[model samples]
Target: MFHHILVPTDGSPLSGMAIEKSVALAKSLGARITFLTAVEPFHIWTDNANQLAYTREEYERISKESAGGYLDSAVAAAEAAGVAVGRVQVETDEPYRAIIDAAVERGCDLVAMASHGRRGVAALVIGSETQKVLTHSAIPVLVYR
Candidate 1:
């Protein structure tokens, strides 16, 4: 019953699998899929001084290009599966916030993503972005491991 589906990817193998799943599900349900990627802002600093630059146009351009490649792959996969798809990318320091915002802004009803399946020390070391999205998103999230 999903009209708009948001599929967030990091270009990882696990995220690729999630994209496949999302595409298949969308095809079955006759839903439109939105493939999204969040590029973290580039940080530039010196040894003595620290400064944050969020308005680097070149950085944003590169990020958009990188995200476009990933989104292109997702679109191809969905098209091959006979599913309608679109894409969106945003540059932000907070990836989770960017993803959730994009989903809401695009009017997506569901978010389908992959769990890296990190556990134990690894999980602790690198916290789960999927978990953060689940915690913060008001929309439904379906995680594929």
Candidate 2:
């Protein structure tokens, strides 16, 4: 019986699945949904050479546009499903933290998100944000793989 559901997405195929699932769940439960997207801030010192390709201003602009696109798709899905929806965007490298914080700030009772289900060395190397959110969040988490 979640009154408010927080749906965090990255615009990936798996995240799209979670968005669809959460929209259906929200519609059934009569819960309002809040879609959250976290955009990484521009970092001057990064190992990735691609990051250095853009200036700080340019990188921030590009990141915001990309994040906005992701949030827009999620919003469109919820709207199409006739579900009440809101959206939040934060500039932070720690997406997991942003997800948890947004849920609390927005008074969301549950977090519905996607997981790649990576395990072993791959998971450790990639460092799953879903795993981090699961570990850190106090609210209920519905993970869609």
Return the top candidate by lDDT: 2
Instruction: Show where candidate 1 strays beyond 4 Å.
Output: 45-63, 117-127
Write down the RMSD of all candidates, one decimal each: 6.0, 4.4
**Residue range 92-144, candidate 1, lDDT tens digits:** 65666777898899899998988752221111101367889899999999988
- Cα shift from native, residue 49, model 2 (Å): 4.7
Error of 2 at 16 (Å): 0.7
Q: Using Cα atoms with residue i matched to residue i, what is each candidate's TM-score against the true structure? A: 0.79, 0.88
Q: Residue 74 of candidate 1: its Cα lDDT? A: 96
lDDT (C-alpha) at residue 101 in model 2: 94
Clashing pairs in 2: none
Using TM-score, give the best candidate's number.
2
The TM-score, computed over Cα atoms with residue i paired to residue i, of candidate 2 is 0.88
